[model samples]
Target: MPQTTVNLRSLFLLSPDVIFLNHGSFGACPREVFTEYQRWQLELEINPVEFLGRRSGELLLYARTALGKFLGARPQDLVFISNSTAGVNAIAKSLKLKPGDEVLSTDHEYGACDNTWELVCREQGATYVKAAIPLPFDSVSFCDRVWQKVTPRTRLIFFSHITSATAVPFPAQELCARARAARILTMVDGAHAPGLIDLDLEKLGADFYVGNCHKWLMAPKGSAFLYARESAQPLAQGLVTSWGYSERTALNADQEAYAGRETFERRHQWQGTRDIAAFLAVPAALEFRRKYGWERMRAECRTLAALTQERILAANGLAPVVSGDDILQMLAIPVPRAGAERLQKWLFNERRIEVPVTAFGDMAFVRISVQAYTTQAELDALVSALAEFYKDKGNS
Candidate 1:
């Protein structure tokens, strides 16, 4: 499959001393996208009130509209947030849970998000159940495993579109549909999904969906979105409620006030007046992806990612957690759990290799993030570092 060549390295403003292979954690922005982001920032500084207060509403509406159409969603259903964390927080805050009400999810969720649900459940008297889905999962089997956690008390099914540590793409549409049939609210944390995987938020059928534009979309940091289905929109009370409340009594009218999604839009949209430039940079990112024909680029990156996993694991000192066929843009290669921190530290402190050594349960993995700019030479260097580390330790 022939596609245009992309220099993934040229996109980042990172220093030359760093060999960044951790696109999965926080994505590297393209030079062009950064240019657009800075332009918006400058415009904001030029007239903060005019840019943020006066014109921002309409500008954001347009951005949301463009983003919604791209995601196969409605403008009203999508709103901007700092990141997927904030988006999920908005949903968690809005939900009213009883003492025994259960929120079912898998164990592979991001640590912070797990905390978010845990704390929220504690306060609301709801039970948060983490489904124990085993590794090396097929979609059907994974769904079956997670479904076992659902009971009569299960009010919500919180799932991830793509997991963080494992880098596995969950069968979210299947789970969302099943939850829909059961009349259970489903909130999907699509933190790594938007550009890395194909997205159709409307068709995904989750009651609440949140994604970050920064990851894989090449948008500036703090660009993210919260999408709520028309039905679930009522559950949102902004993480910090500023406006979208009754000016007079501060009482939310169940009868007179909009029992719908107005609360989510009004409250969450204006969260104590922060920088709006990042939000405005979203359109630029989208446009950049469109111009680059990101579908082709994504396929190419996945291929490179699979190859990197294969070559690295095939080496004597390297092993892998997941197979190449299942890998997306990121692959987790197993190394000595004891030496994991040392290897990572040595590579960064000595070799200037900017990669992440992630610890999962009892496993230590050298997680490499493959993007359009990743090259064979860099991959070779990473492999060499591992080989050298093992040889020096007399482990191989």
Candidate 2:
């Protein structure tokens, strides 16, 4: 009922004809931020050499400073990447995993990240161990369940701070603290945490962390960051060995003069000439959130997401995978185990509803993301469609 929540819908560029309930997949950028992104692109095209050659380092540093302040990390510890997947690949490939070594993670991880670890472990003869954390998650017992799988050969612990498939928020601080005591390296897939939840990378005690600004923070696409603890920086080299690599010493001294002094930035920041507009416009996204009182908007969206889940679950007669408090703006509601693809297409093609249908184990979920642009009527339409669709098959 907050006026800001209703009015905020107009600020985004998403189509008014469609009910977009999939902000979790890719965040919707505000008009202001998109304009800033374009301005940066224009500046880049105006003089390629001036922007990429002479001024990119300082411009990126300013952008990183803003992002670091937002993430509760130092600029020196963070570097811009395309997305969380890129960050995961960089770290996964960089870790020294011998045969019989293990990388421990939960079953609720993102699919791309899971594949990244699986490939790395496959190549090195290391094992990728997945802890099967049961549904209706209990935060108190979460760490205990994951810790039971740890062994002397366990080299790393990786889990999502907020899981993508199930939309559950894990207790990262407790798990990270436990991993630290056990002398196991910890890497967090925090793709959903940056804006949906508060993050203090320094205090979280994780050796490595990655967050997607393009998801919750409402930044332009291709904007994300990787934060490495000072101790862990040496272990995470760039996935693409570019001019940032130390052995590429022909340009290291000159690169250091302009690319800043930190090895983390030196290694990861410059990965061939690509669009840096998204990275540079991150400050504008932050400014838009601050200007529009996005905290209140996000809180309202959380309440809406919970209500949306309750309505869908009531229609399908299925239990939830996670409690309401465990999710923020995104809610994963269990749908009938019929055809998830059919239901998803039906909703989009027939009802003009935009939402994701995901299958986990034997269950199918309709993951709904309630953002500032979402409306009660839009959600009601989705609920009505689901009830009607399932009723046609006598499943509701």
Candidate 3:
């Protein structure tokens, strides 16, 4: 698309009045994909019995196959989940975390995921330790820093492929290799990865991974997936109760990773029935991305994001959260004053610029996420709003 045709206003379903700069929190569905999603919903509503009865299985298979191809995963190994939290919850809850077994994860994990691990570990008599990766993170040194936390009791290493608050891409390939060598379970939270990062599930080499399609993949809300390595599938279980399960009568494929051992039917696939349209729309999202040249499109998005990061930080006298290479599509920088939340509120109320100003650790910061539909002008709008917010400081 031409630069002008890449109008931020037209490409997304965002409100005409709001300048949306938070594509990272929850993805902004493109107008075309949103239309397709609505169409699928309408089709399902027209004949709930017929659509979900005879054709639901087939429809799910088609979407799964298409999404698996997009992620370079086998359809059978991937299961649809509402989001990454639920996906990881299914894995974490099913794991047999005996006493003295430690689940080492980074401090940068999303709050909800941290709670998920805490809840699961508390019940299973396991320890969940936060491995602090010093800020201004150097990816080459990240593995060693995290490795120092590991001990003979360390049974699993969990971390994010892209940190939600920090927006740093942790070097997982080397770390997963080390964990595999030690026979330690390796799982990752990849919620922000798929479309933002070049993903080859086989290459990531984690025992299990889950990410959101609604975030970077631009799918409708509630569309995401969990990918478990074939060897690790036995530990899998559904987080909800459902009829998809075979009772005590196990399927031909059964093992000890916990899928059969836990309530996979009741927990995961049988989340009781809601809108299947969002999931059914995943293939359309994948196809739209594929046909639209997603790879180059992602690269362009990174370029725009980098430009925004540079322009804003330079104007605000702040530093880049991490080097351009280490971060993905989002950048997190410390806010100039106390109460980043107040600044977030001020920015929105005064400027109509919908951006994120979140507090992480001791520092208050703004996390900026850039998407393909975004333009330099929108980024400039954000900069102007922030600079104006602190206009008396004369930084801009």
Candidate 4:
């Protein structure tokens, strides 16, 4: 593969002193996108009524249209939310899971999402079943393992498209197909998948999917979206009951049309008054990627992530949890056993490198994210730090 020739590090607003290898956590937005975000904010401040009350619906429609085009979904089927967890909460709370009903998921889900299901299941007297997927992942057996856990009581299946802790890309399409055959609804957590991978929510056929534009897509913070298939739209209710809840109280002709919008949008779009600059700036983030040929850039980033994983694991003498092809621009490499927090802080404080050390069960791993702005030298810095950390362990 040809390497990216353009220098991209300068386009981001990340600190020059810190080697940022943690893009998977909270993304770093490009300077151009941030400027566009601020422009929207200024416009909102100049006339709050015009921005939020009067013209906000039309403006938001345009933004959602752009995002919908990018994700291959109808604009009416999508609604802007603060984050993926918010989307999960909206759907989880809305579902009327009866007593003895079960919601199936993998063991590799995000912590906050797991908490959402745990609390919801407890309140509703339902069971949340997390099927264990063994390491050294087998794609062939992946769907079977998950399907085997499903019982007649299983009402829904929820899993991440790309897992956060393990950095493995689950076979979401296959799982969705399987769940559909069994008359179970599927909701996909695509938090890290928007810009990192090719997506067509319509073709993927999940009942509901939520993704973060702020993560791999490089949008500003507080930018994310929830997608519902036309048939499933009525099942989703907003976390906050705001103006969009009723079409009878439309503010104006245009506002009324927005208020009488699709059941999905009308419920979730206007969630009280909040900063919508991040959501509106999603188009700018898409433009930035288009101008820079982000497909090739993502390929280069994935190469760097795989290479860094190889370099780090070679020193620690531990095998990788997932195949290189299964992941995109992020990788989780098993490291010498140690406290995850201690390992993370040591890397940040001693090495001036910002990375995440996460533990799954007893194994500890260092999750590295390579973005368009990442370079070989920063990865080299991480590799060197791990080598020193291993040496310190020997000496101790």
Candidate 5:
């Protein structure tokens, strides 16, 4: 671990007593970023009309520009959303589906987004096909498995860039290209990819890519984005029709003579008069990470996560879901069946360690997230707690 990360802990507001191993669930905002968030909120309160009505559009565009630069996207193609789930819903709801049409995805997708597709498919009389790609597989093998499930009925392909519970990285770029070759639309749920990995939306070539800034980017809550390729913009519609709809149409006509009238960002940017402080504070979050040498910190965090996974696997006699090189800042290790929740509760109550013991099908996993604030001592405490818990279970 980097020595600077120990000092960087003071930059966050996390409790000193609790070992926070769940940065993947919702990221902890740094003090500077949170201050900027509050400053925006205070500015909005001082003069609501001036802040929201007169100045919000320009401010939002500026923030979006900064975020676009970070993600390697065009400012016009990206729009702000509350989270990846909302982004997925926007794309899924807008798609024209019919009976016998299939939306192909993997079993490793996030549960909430999976529900969105299922509900949309049910309403449209379409089929949601979940391809079962087992772990410990290479990118080529996994892509082949998912591609084999596609048929003439498959209209769309959706999967996570990095899975939620399992923490596996899928071959999204390769799959997207294959889907394009087959004339199928592609959507990528990149909820955990933004801050964890370097992103280039244009090069990745997904029709729609959704990522959360709050999770890995160190941004405030309700800050996420959706990037739609130019060709696919017509297929996207906002969940709620608002000011962006007619306003953008007129603006597009004036600016480009209706040349770029069909835009996804314009259709979804303004949903209502909501508190957009989080969205506006994205630049601050980006600056904070840059000032703190986030790239090096991320590398250190990945090393810490791999070390922790090795220690836990050695102690528990468990197999790894993927190779050590595949693990990033998060790793999910299998635990005893029916004991995951018990162990999670015990770690929280006994050791004040906050981590997720997620259940996926017949298996239970202890997912650990390593961040700049995390330390080896905290991880050691968790390992010690788990050792005690298993010893007690053996005696009982």
Candidate 6:
């Protein structure tokens, strides 16, 4: 495979000593986007009363409008949250689960979100079902495996759009359509899908979708969004109740006068006046990506990811979790042993390479994320480091 010659690392503020291949963990912000984030913070700090009291709502609306447009969603149906975990928590806590009700999901979900659902289900006397999705996944087999786990007691279906541990993209649109036909609500944790893929929320047909702008979108930290369909909006409640809740109730009482009110965005927008500068900087992040031709960059990154996957598989004589077509910007290859922690520490300490070695049950996977700032040489360095590690472990 030919190497990608374009190098955009200088645009980011990453350290010169380390090769960053872990953009999927927490995205690195570009210099331009970081400047815009600081600008919003400075504006807010200059006059707290004027910014938060007078102009915050309008500024948030503008940011939401830009973000909704990018995600192919209505601005009224979207609300900015601190992160995707908060969005997941809001939906999980708001649902009224019965003693026998079950929420179905796969085994590849993020750990924090799994904890959130488990806690909510335990409190409500409900069951959280984790279906086993085996290796070498395909769209037909994957969808069938997930659907077979659904039962009469299943009230909702929850899964990740792009899985965290395995970095595989699920067939969410098909699953959402099937769930809707069966009268089961669908919630997708699209934490890594926003900038990695072209998103269209309405067409995708998920009832509720949560995404992180801080991951693949190259936005500042604490920037994420929750999008609910018009019908699903009534079921969503804010984690931290504040003025938005009271105002929503007041509007509900005067429904005749406040008809067509923005219920979803209004009810979740304000939460006790914290720092919203990150939320306000979403538009600048979007603009920065557009100005640099993000679509082409994403395609190039996928090529790099494919090359890296091939190199890793060849080096270790290991199989991939799924085929190359199943992945986009990130790829995961299974390692020989179960000691992911030791491998992660050794890689970071010895090679100065920043990447994730994730443990999935008894198995371990080295997940590589290729971003616009990632180059061919960096991936080569990672390949060389892994070879050295394998030789030391007597696996070569």
Each candidate's number of clashing pairs is 1, 0, 17, 0, 0, 0
Cα lDDT tens digits, model 4, 88-204, are: 999999999999999999999999999999999999999999999988778889999998899999999999999998888888889998889899999999999999889999989
lDDT of predicted model 6: 0.86
Give the runs in model 3 whose Cα sits over 4 Å from its true position. 1-8, 247-270, 392-396
lDDT of 2 by residue, 1-396 (tens): 346534777889999988999999998999889999999999999998888877888899999999999988999899999999999999999998999999999999999999999999999999999998988778889999999999999999999999888888999999999999999999999998999988899999899999999998999999999999999999998878888765434342337574434488788988888899999999999998888888778888888888888888876778988875686788888898886768888899999998999877888899999887777998899989888888785543
| TM-score leader | 4
C-alpha lDDT score of every prediction, in listed order: 0.79, 0.89, 0.78, 0.88, 0.87, 0.86
| Residue-wise C-alpha lDDT for candidate 5, range 1-396, written one tens digit per residue | 676734878999899989999999998999999999999999999998888766776888899999999999999889999999999999999999999899999998898999999999999999999999886546759888998899999999999999998888887889999999999999999999999988999999999999999999999999999999989998999999865555343332222332344456656876777999999999999999899888888888988888888888888887878775678897787777656768788789988999999866777778999997787898898888877887786522
Estimate the Cα RMSD of every predicted model relative to the unseen true structure: 3.7, 2.0, 3.9, 1.7, 2.5, 3.0
Model 6 ranges with Cα > 4 A deviation: 1-7, 247-262, 394-396
Total backbone clashes of model 5? Answer: 0
Clash pairs, candidate 2, are none
| Per-residue alpha-carbon lDDT of candidate 3 for residues 191-238, written as tens digits (9 for 90 to 100) | 998888878888889999999999988999999998888888878878
In model 1, the Cα lDDT at residue 287 comes to: 90
Best first by TM-score, ranked: 4, 2, 5, 6, 1, 3
Clashing pairs in 5: none
How far residue 35's Cα lies from its native spot in candidate 5, in Å, is 0.4
Q: What is the TM-score of each candidate against the true structure?
A: 0.91, 0.95, 0.90, 0.96, 0.95, 0.94
Whole-model lDDT for model 4 versus the true structure? 0.88
Error of 6 at 180 (Å): 0.4
Off by over 4 Å in 4: 1-5, 258-262, 339-341, 394-396
